[model samples]
Target: MDRIAILKLNGFLLVTIQVEMHDQLVLRLQDDLTQMLERTRASGVLIDISGLDIVDSFIGRSLAQIAAIARVMNAATVLVGMKPAVAITMVELGMSLAGVRTAVNVDKGMVLLHEAAGLEAR
Candidate 1:
């Protein structure tokens, strides 16, 4: 997998992962995210999943875990660009992403992250 793109915008770190949606990639992404959160002291995070075709349990779990860790690190995490089919399947599978915020697009996700972090758009 290629190195994920991390962009900082309006107090949020936007991460665009360029890999197949799989367990291993998700775990690696999670580790990188955790380190990024800790090192950057970012106020929020937005994960753009627009390139992903499917989201498996492991990937979902990794996202949730990342959100949890981000909160502890004083950052909010939002998942963006979830495909409709994948969202439906996740809902049907009863997969709970309790603490993670989600949005239909990167723009919306950034807005959510900013709102959660009390950051005014610049």
Candidate 2:
């Protein structure tokens, strides 16, 4: 079962991570989200990580990879709701998260995705 709930909303994939994800769970999420995006043909992906208080290099790298994969599939990726500590940790760990767009919150993320897709915001 997917620990992450991947919901499709307005031609985009909404993923919320509200738990402390183990390594295996995170990997599974990567695979599952990839499949879900392909199956749904979403215009973008918005990952909500406000619930997570920590982010390690492995997790940061995985997030970057997911964004890269989405871009290859012609879908935009917007990471949202990252905590301040998480941001500090990622910077300290030298995780640039290239190719991954970020927003302060889900609303802004949706706006970015909508703009990228050339759709009017709802």
Best by TM-score: 2
Give one digit per residue, the lDDT tens place, for model 1 in 6-77. Answer: 776655688886567666667777788788777788999898887877787777778888889989898988
Q: Per the 3 Å backbone cut-off, how many clashing residue pairs does candidate 2 have? A: 0
Model 2, range 26-75, lDDT digits (tens) per residue? 89989999999889999899999998998888889999999999999989
Candidate 2, position 10, lDDT? 81
For all candidates in order, the CA lDDT equals: 0.80, 0.92
Could you tell me the lDDT of residue 105 within candidate 2?
98
Q: State how far residue 2 of model 1 sits from its true place (Å).
A: 4.3
**lDDT at 45, model 1:** 87
> Candidate 2: where are CA atoms >4 Å away?
none
